[model samples]
Target: MGPPKPSITISQQAFDEMVKENIDDLGMDPTEALQDAIETLTLQGVDLSGIVTCKEDPVIQSLDRLKQLNSNWTDRIGKDGDEVMDLLDKLTELCSAEGSGNAAIGTRNGGIELVCSVCSKLRGGSDQGLVSGLKTLASLLHDVQSGDTFQRSGGPKMVMAILSDISQSSNILNGGFSVVAAAATGNEIVKESFMELKIDELMLQILRTHGEGSIHSLYDAIRILLTPDDNRVVASQVYGYARRFAKTGIAEVLVESLKEGLSSPSLVSATVTLKAVAVNDEICRSIAESGGVDAVLRCIDDSGEQGNQTVARVCCSLLSKLAGSDTNKSAIVQKGGMDRLIKLAARFSDDPSVLQEVMSIISILSLRSPDNAARAIEAGAGDLAIQAMQSFPGAHQMQRNACLMIRNLVARSPENRTLLLHNEIWGLMTTTNRIFTMFKQSTFFQELLI
Candidate 1:
C-alpha cells in the first residue's frame, strides 16, 4: 500500500529517562557499572582498548608516611621507631643478599635491593635501608641481567608507591629492566617476579599506577617487568591500563606514552617496553594499523647506518611477528620499508649477520607464497638478498637461509622455479640442506621435486 507507515518507537528523551531511572533504581553509578562491564570484557580477553582508563590512582599510602615524617617528630618513635629501624635493618640485609640468594646470607642479584632501598629510605636519617638498598641495587645492576626481581612482594608490593607514595624518589625512571636510581634512599622494586618466587596477589594494585615522581619505583619496576619472560605481565597491565584510559573514549594519553617510548631517540628500556607491549597481537596490530609500524619501519629501513644500528635491531626484533603476513608485507612495502631494508643491506654489505636478519624477514615473506615473493622482488629486495646469501662464504647458516629464500621464490613462480632448476637448485641444496633446515620445517622439507 502507500509504502507502509513507519513503526512506532519510544521517543529518545522518554527512552533515556526510563533507562536512567532504571539505572538509578539499581543503586549503582552508571559510570562504575560501565567500568565493571569493561573489566568483565578484559577478563574474557576482548579488545577494551580506547574504552578503558588509566585512572589517576593516588600514589600509595607511603606518601602520607613521608608527609608524616616531615610533620611530627617524637610522634612515631621508640618501639614504633624501633619497628621502622628493624624493618630497615632486615630489608637492608635482605637487599644486600647476593649471588642469586642461594647461599645463606649471600648477596643476591635480585629484588632484595629494591626492598632494601625502600625500607632503608623509610628508616631515614639513620638511613639504614637506604644505604643498603642503593648499594645492593647498584651491585645487582652490575651483575643481574634485569631488574624485576622479587624480594618483599609481587607487582603490587613493589609498585605500592606508584599506587600511593613517591616523594622520597629522585628519579626512578625506566632505562633497562626499570632503573630505580634513588636519591640514595628511594626508587625501588617490582617489575615482574623474575626473581626466585612468583607473585600472585595485588595485581590490580600494581597495575593501577600511571604516575611518576609521585612514586619511587614505578618506572624502574615497569621497565624490569617488561623484560623477556618478565614481559609476560604487559598484556594484562596494558589491557588494564587501556580499559581504564578508554573510559574517556580517548586513548591519546595512554597511547601517547606508549608511542613516545616507541619513538624515543634512546632505544632504552622504554623502547623495550614498547616491544613487549606490542607482543599482544591486538595491541601490536592496533599500533601497526595506527601508524606505529611506519615509525618502526623507518627504523627498520635505516638499519644501514651504524648510528641506527640499535634502532634497527630493536625494530627487527619487535617487527618479527608483524611481518609474518601478506597484508603486513604489502603494508611494509607501501610504507617504504623494503627500500630501507635494501639500503641497510647495502650499507652493511660486509656485515653478513645483519644481511642475514634482513634476508630472513624477506624470506619469511616470500616463503612458498608466490604473490608475496613477487611483491618482495618488485620492492627491489631480490637481487641484494640473493647476493647476501651467496656472497658470504664459510658458515652455511646464512647460505642455507639464502638458499631457502631463493628456493621459495622459485617454488612460488613456475618460471622462477624453472629458472632455479635450470640454475641447479638441487646442487645448492645438496650443497647446504643441513644449514637451511634449522629455519623452519615447512621450508626445508617440502619435497621440492613433487
Candidate 2:
C-alpha cells in the first residue's frame, strides 16, 4: 500500500529518540522528538506513510491523550493551566512541522469554538493550565487560521505565533480544501499580520509560502521596507528575508524582469535574492555552479541606482563576498564585475556625487579581501579609483577609503600594503589629505603609510 512507505521510514525506536530532545532541541524527550519528527516528515511526505498507516504507532497513541485533554482544557485552564501549557510546549517542540509550501488545513466548527475560547472570559486566579496550553492554542490557531475566520485576529502575539508555525511543516494541519480556500481568501489580513513579524525569518517563511494569495501585499511590504524615505531603518528586514527564503518562482520572475531591461528595478528583489541564496555554502555552491550566476551578473550589467540603495549595496556585496572563494569568485570576476565597475565609474567620472557611491563600493570590496582588490587593480580599478580622487569633487572620501582598505592588508601582512603600491597606494596621500583634515593621523591617511 502507498508504494511501500520509503525504506527510510522512522521506526518506533527512532521516533522515541526525537521525543527525548526536550522542547528546545536535542533536549526534547526522544518519544516526543520522534513524534515531532514524524509529523514533520509525514507532511513533507518523508517515507513515514507506512508508520502513519500502521495506525497503532505511539504517536497516534499519544494523540489519544489530546482527545481526552480537549474535554479537560476548560478544566485545565481553570485548574491546571501551567501543566496544560507544558504539555503543549512539548507538543510544539516535538511535533513542530515545517512549512510544506502547500499547507493544507481545515475549518472544523469545533476548532472555531476553541479559537473563540482564547479570548473568552478569564477563569478565577491564575489560569490553572501550564504554558504548554498556549503552544497548543497557538498550533490550533495557526491551523484554524490557515482555513477559518480567525484569520484576522487583532492581537499581535497571535499573529506572530501563527507565522512561527512555519518551523513546523504547514502540512501538520492540512485538514481539507476548504481550509486552503479560506486562507487564500484572507490574503491581505495575513500580509498585514506579517508587517509586525517581518523581522522574524520563520514568519517571513509563512508570508512567502502561505501568503502567496496576497502576493501584491507581500511585494508592497518589500516596497515599504525599501522605500527611499524610510529604508535605512527597516530595509534590512525585507532584504534579510528575501535572501534567506525567496521562493523558487522568484528566479523566473526576476529573469523575466532583467530580460525586460530596466523595466522594474530588478535589483530590489532579484539582486537581493541572488545574494541571499548565495550566502550559505550549500545554497551558494548550487547556484554559483548553475546559470544563476550569469543571470545575476547580467542584472548588474542592466540595472542602475533607481530603487533600494541597499539592494544595490547587496549586489556589490555579493560580488565582493564571493571574491576570495574560488567557486563563486571566479564566476564574479569572469562575469565582468571588475570591468563593469570600471564602466560605472567612467559613466559618472565627472559627477563626484555619483562617483562617491561608486568609490564607496570600491572601498567595501577592497577590504573584502586583498585578492579582490588585486583583481580590481588588474581590471584597471586602481586607475579609476585614483583618478576618481579628483573628480570625486566632495571629500576625497574615495582616496581616504582606499587608503583605509589598504591598511587592513597592511596590518595582516606588510605584503598587503606592498600590493597596494601597485594600485599606486602611496600617490593618493595628498588626495587622502584633502578628504581628511587631520591627514597624518586620519584613518585612511594612516593606511597609506602602512
Candidate 3:
C-alpha cells in the first residue's frame, strides 16, 4: 500500500538486546517494549516482514503479503513495478532460507500459481519484476513437493513462454532456467514433461543466440536435463539424453565455451555441463574430436597459473572423464595433456584433492596402454604419485588414488615397475597398504595393490 520497505536481517540476539534496552533504559513493560521496538525498526525502514516471532507464522504472513499484492495487481499494474519487484524479492529470500519450511508452506498455499500469474502479467511490461518473479518461483520449487505442484500446474509451459518472450534478456533467461532446473531435479515426470516440451531445442537455440553472453545457469539447466535421477530403473534415459545433446550440436557449443577465456565460475559451469553430457565413449570421442581435450588442457594450465585450484581441479576431472575414450586418451597425451597435469600437480601440491584428481587422470590414461604408461613415468607421474602418498598419508582417497595410479603405471610396463620400486616406492606402497589394512574393509584396496 506504501513504499516497499528495505529487506534487512537482525540477529535474534541483537533483536532481543534491543527489546531489553527498551525495557531497561526506557522503563517500558515487556509488551510495550516489544511493540515499541517493532514500530521503531519499521519507521527506520527495516522490513520485519519475515522475522521469526512467537506470536505469528512468518511463512503464512509472507504468503498473505504476496496474495495481497496479486489481488491488487490491476490497480498497480503499470504504476508500481518496484513494489512488485520488492515483494518478489522478499518472497525469494524467505523461500531460500535453509530449513525454514517457507518453500513447502508457499507451495501448499498455491504459491506457484500466484508467481506464474505475476510472471504472465509482468511479461512485455517489467523485465525486473518478471525476473524477480521467476527467481521467487525457482526458490519455491526447490522442494520436491513444490516441484510436483509446479509440474501439475503447467508451470513449465509458463516458464518456456516467459523464456521465449525474453530470450534476449540474460537476466530473465537465467531466472527462467533456474526454475526449470529446480523443477527437473529428482522429478522424472517433470523432466519428461519438459522433454516433451522440446526444452532441449529451446535451450540450444538460446545457447546459440547468446553463447557469447555466457549464461552460466543455462549450462546448469542443460546438465540437469541430461543427468539421471535416483531411480535407476529409468537411468538409461540419461544416455539417450546425452546422445541427443551431442547430435543436436550441444557438445560443440560447450566445447567452444570452454575455449573462451571465461571467468572462473563460467569455466567451471561449462566444463561440468560438458562432463555431464559425455555419458558414453562415443560422445566422449565426439567432444575430444571437437577440440574439447585441448580446451580443457588449456583451462587447467590457465587456472593453475592463476592459482585457481577449483577451476584447475574441475578441468582435470572433466579431462579424466573425456579420457575414458581410448582415442581421447591418446589425443590428450599428444596435445601435452600429461605435461599440463604434471605441472598442475606441482603447482597445487599442498592440495591433496587436486593431486588426487591429477592422479586419477594419469591412472585413466595409463590403463592398459604401455606406451602411455611409459610416457606418464617420463612426465614424472611416479614421483608425483610418491610425493602425494608421502605428503597426505591421512588422505584416504588420495592414497587410494595414488596406489591406483601406481598400479596402472606398472601393470603393463615391467620397466616402469622396476623404476618405481627403485625410487623407494616400495616403502610408500607399504605405508599406503598399511593405511588401507587398518580400515580392514577395503577389498578394492587389495585389488589395486595386487
TM-score of each: 0.54, 0.41, 0.82
> How well is each residue in 81-108 modelled by candidate 1, as lDDT tens digits?
5544443334334434453332111222
Clashes of 2: 45
Off by over 4 Å in 1: 1-159, 162-170, 173-263, 305-307, 325-327, 367-369, 393-404, 419-426, 436-450
lDDT digits (tens) for residues 160-241 of candidate 3: 8887753548998998999999998877777778877888788888888876345778877888887777352435476777
Cα-based lDDT at residue 367, candidate 2: 56
The candidate with the higher lDDT, 2 or 3, is 3
lDDT of 2 by residue, 1-450 (tens): 333443454554554444445455666654565567767766866554223323343334434454455555664455545544454444444334555211122122233334324323222324323223333334444432442355443433443443344433333222211222233232434333444454335424444565332222333334333222321133334344334343433433434433443445434554454444444554555555555556555545553434333434445555554443456656666576667766655655665544455555555555546666666666765566567664553555555654454454454344545556766656654545554554565554455455
Question: What is the descending TM-score order?
Answer: 3, 1, 2
Off by over 4 Å in 3: 1-55, 69-79, 231-236, 262-265, 433-435, 438-450
Q: Clashing pairs in model 3?
A: none
lDDT of each: 0.45, 0.45, 0.81
Number of the candidate with higher lDDT, 1 or 3: 3
Residue 360's lDDT within candidate 3 is: 96
